[model samples]
Target: MEMNLDSVKVVGFDADDTLWVNETYFRETEERFAELLESFETKNKIDQELFKVEMQNLDLYGYGVKGFILSMIECALQLSNHTISNDTLQEILDVGKKMIAHPVELLSGVEEVLQKLENKYRLIVLTKGDLLDQERKLEKSGLSKYFHHVEVLSEKKEENYQNLLEHLEIDVNEFLMVGNSLKSDVIPILNIGAKAVHVPFHTTWAHELVSKEKEKSTNGYLKLESIKDILDYLKH
Candidate 1:
């Protein structure tokens, strides 16, 4: 990985989970959502149905707390056969609002890693979600000063990375993406001929899970236990 990243000039970081806590909130919300509909169905069933609704509405709503809230509402309506009370519905909205209003929790060693790499590399944030929400989080994180650019992508496929890199005038060979999700951060960046470092978070959303075979096939990307470990490879 060090050999591959020796030429890297720009480092793209994934915002949620990589730099700070994110999926844990969604998990907590899911538990609350399940409880809200517990009388209608088992918690397991509610979780499955809500996930299905979210997947069904993915293209329509994209990824973010807003879409998740809508999915939960839809699931509640379906699970309760349209008999869901207005008060319960309001509670769902409040839960999502709370997630949005939740404070940013930076991961361990995140600031230290960013600070060390800031002068050596052009740091940028490339994340996918609601633009306004992402920007709001970045502002609250107070780590935005270290980045040269911040992009809120609707998706993180190869083309998205390719286009953004091209627009930013960064060569793929000279770029390194560091993030938590292998599906979003590592795999796509590796596929695009760029270098990537996988810094796994304790919790990952189901949509971001990759198969073991898929993980094994991908070569050249480094998987580290902590973000701070990257300094050993990238630091001069």
Candidate 2:
């Protein structure tokens, strides 16, 4: 674990899993959704079809409800042969939207750590999703008060991070990105010469999974089993 508190001033977090439980709710909703499609298509087929559309919608719709809605729409039309009624589609849409307003709970020690770090570090939240949904979740979580800035990103690419670093007036290496999802939060930032601390979540999201690990990174990349481990890393 490589960390130097002096080298970092702005600590940006990848919301969702880092600050609160996000994937568990998404998983529960997806399980029920998968059940709904079982009669129309096999689980394997349904997953395959949905993933195909999600790949295309990544840029067009982005993450959160918009992407989930597009995925469900594509899934319904594919499974139902373009015959699925609007009512059923609406139900899925409702579910996707509802996910945002769902009660957001912090993983154990998240509030404590944030409270401890906020006084010393300029903490900000960097999340990719529907802006409104992200804000609502942050507000509902009661953790919004602690952050100095909140960036709701459309995508988590190398450029998005580079732009953020420039806009925030900070060097890539000066910012420490703490979050889950190696593909989104770790890899791209590392590409830009930034330091990233990966806090692995217990329940990872389906879309967030990179499904592969590539070559080793030259940038400092530290991985932790849980968010609480962050305290130890920061203390040193």
Candidate 3:
């Protein structure tokens, strides 16, 4: 479907994966988590069960490292029938601490893209995660100056985007969302009559993966190779 940028005024960006390294850390942590539980279950089984736990806890813990750590702890206890060692539990907590402490690594040309668009349009961050953790990353990113607003959403859905636009007083057709997840970032905005740009990251969470059929049916979005390409698309 063709997208018209002529009406666009406000640009929203997704935090993890889209602007910086995020999902890769989760994948790495899952590997470590699987290893921690290897004695009770195979690596593959542990991985599957962990995913199940995360999905089940989405409402309770929401998203981010804290929720992931809790899910890992719960999975470990279940896999071991409540016999998992305290040391292993501590190790699981350490895994989350390490992830939380990791420095924010911005994607290539992220700052440049933000700089290019900063003055031309109102820019904001529309991301879902632990509020404190998302705020910490934004502070560390040093790109906070580029955004007029930063919203840490509990979830990303059509209604969430609609409310955000209303809160910001932006017309649906005049807002463009840029992010890496088709499920969270692209599809919802498209469904709400807003434009979206899909800047894909190499590593995606299993939960965010949409079926090929679902992807094919989505419209009113553009797919670009990198965040930097957004400058070319929107700067004309």
Where does model 3 exceed 4 Å of error?
A: none
lDDT for every model? 0.93, 0.81, 0.92
lDDT of 2 by residue, 1-236 (tens): 66654677778998888888887887777776777777788887777777788877877888886677778878788889988878788888888878766888888888888988888888999998889889888988899899999999888999999998899898776788988888899989888988888888888766677644452433468888777777876642
Report the poorest 10 consecutive residues by lDDT, candidate 2.
211-220
lDDT of 3 by residue, 65-168 (tens): 99999999999999999999999999999999999999999999999888889889999999999999999999999989999999999989999999989988
User: Which scores better on lDDT, 2 or 3?
Assistant: 3
Using lDDT as the measure, name the better of candidate 1 and candidate 3: 1
**RMSD list, candidates in order:** 1.0, 2.2, 1.1
* TM-score to native of every candidate shown: 0.98, 0.90, 0.97
For model 1, the local distance difference test gives: 0.93
Query: Best to worst by lDDT, what's the order?
Result: 1, 3, 2
Residue 158 CA displacement from its true place in model 1, Å: 0.6
Candidate 1: tens digits of C-alpha lDDT, residues 14-73: 999999999999999999999999999999999999999999999999999899999999
- lDDT of model 1, residue 91: 99
lDDT, residue 140, candidate 3: 98
